[model samples]
Target: MPYFDSERFASLLEKEGFSASQAKAVINALNDVVDESTVNVTDDLITKEEQQKTIERYKNDFRQLKTDIQRMEKNDVEDVKSANERLKADIDKLKKTLQDELIRSQAGVRLDLNLEKGRIRDETVEQHDRLKNTDEKIANEIQALKTQMQGIKMQILRYMIGTITGAGTLVLGYIHFSH
Candidate 1:
């Protein structure tokens, strides 16, 4: 079943010449007074609850038919003859109802599947874009870190060279003075 948004319904009612407040009041009343169980099946509108009940009833009938079939298979000749006839009739009725309900349920299933698929696709695209942007930011940060590390390494090398030269000069001066 399609989602029912009260705001959208009210907007539609207002567009049809009802005052905003009046539209809201009417929509509220409609929501309060509508009894799904009391709906007439012959009418064009099938409430969600009614459809669900029908599907459940069909499922139950099908289960009973299966049980009956099992019983017939285990019975004596006389019992089998009578039970088989009843089983056949019950099976036929259950089959017909099940087929009809299956078709109806399939229609709802198809609609739900389409909506879910669209939602999934949209989320996937959004996630892909977010990941791409994040990856680019990380890559830029990594490059900046590499440059800073190289600069720090160069500074350390310069300090080490200066220290080594100063030590060697001091040693030579001491040896020359002692001689």
Candidate 2:
């Protein structure tokens, strides 16, 4: 994956009163945490797929078990009632175990997904804040430059007017004195 520009991010953070090293550390921590959490989600997805396959295989096995139990109840000899009861209890226990495993797997997936989303949200907010601050700083700098340029222009205009007025007065004086 492409890494973010930590130097730039650190500089921005520094502007908000964080020390340079502290800013860098913060950026590094954010990147590490996000990457680690995202990787965890990826792992969770793989585990979830495996769990689903396991559940499917168990479902097939449970079906076969049910068929076997039914056949034993119908055709088996003495203690048929007790055998049926035991088989039913075993099936119920297996179902409960599968259900619990499924719930746990689903919950793990959801928790991982939620953490990934939260990390993304935090990064986005931080980026937006940095961008906003940068924009404001640039705007202020531009305004200051504009003000300085305007002042220079005004001074240049005044100098030009004064020079023209002085020349005109000198010309009129020479003409009057000669005539």
Candidate 3:
């Protein structure tokens, strides 16, 4: 608040060539306006100390939030790592199971193939025996035909000699009778 004296202001105004009554009226009006005026101090304007404390409080809250977020992120990473481990274990077990089944199936197929091969070999052996017997029978028949051919040649030779001797005897008898 500013303090002023009406006497001094009016006296100064009178020295500046104003009439005393005019000076007094002007001073009185000035005083009336001052007294009627008002100055307000609202809470919108903060003190320096209050502003510094609020800034520090906000800084602390931001730091705590950052720590909380980091902790959550670390938990999420651990969860993912553990899940991956479980999945890897499952995949390994599945691979082993599939490999075992494949080995068993292969062994079964091999056993079947060996059995079939043995059966085919037995059939071939039986067929070979039948063909051998047939060949022996044909050989015996050819030998019998050779022996019969030799007997026929001997009988033809004997018949040709007897016919020659009878013709010679008939010629001798005819000559004697004619003479």
Candidate 4:
């Protein structure tokens, strides 16, 4: 608080043409006003030292929180990397499995084709053998028929010659009897 010399203030007001009693009364009233306007210091307001300590504590807490957040982020990144590696391994396995299945399928198809080809070849050979046997049987039957026809032709020729000879003999006997 600044020093307020009431006597000096009263002297100055008296020099300004106020009476001594009025000057004293004015000084008393000013003192009352000053006293009324002044703020009283109390325990509710904190000291600078206490404020500095609180700020330090808050700074420390903030640093710890930052560290914790960084650690959590690093762990999350590692987990993501592990999961990515597992996915890559699974994809590789699936590709290999698909390739193996394709190979097996192709091999099975090839085996079936080979078996089918063999079966077709056997059937074609059997059909050819049957046709050959049928041709041979037909040839034999044609030869037997030709032989039988030739024997019948020879017998008819011999019978025709014998009848002609008997007719000639009868004519000769008739002429001799008439004579």
Query: Which has the greatest TM-score?
Result: 4
Tens-digit lDDT track for model 3 on 10-125? Answer: 89999999999999899888877766663223335678899999999999998887777667556755665575567557656855775676577557656755665566677877
What ranges in model 4 sit over 4 Å off? 2-5, 13-44, 117-179
Backbone-clash count (model 4): 0
| 92-135: candidate 4 lDDT, tens digit per residue | 68557756765775576567556655665778877666655655
Q: Report lDDT (Cα) of residue 122, candidate 4.
A: 75
| lDDT tens per residue, model 2, 113-169 | 566556657787776566556556656755775676578557656755665575566
lDDT of 2 at 19: 97
lDDT assessment of candidate 4: 0.68
Alpha-carbon RMSD, each predicted model: 47.2, 53.9, 49.8, 49.5
Query: What lDDT does the true structure give each of the candidates?
Result: 0.66, 0.68, 0.66, 0.68
Q: Measured by TM-score, how close is model 2 to the native structure?
A: 0.32
Candidate 1 local distance difference test against the native: 0.66
Q: Candidate 3 has what TM-score?
A: 0.47
Off by over 4 Å in 2: 1-12, 44-49, 77-179
> What digit string (tens of lDDT, one per residue) describes model 1 on residues 114-166?
66556657787776666556556656655765676578557656755655565
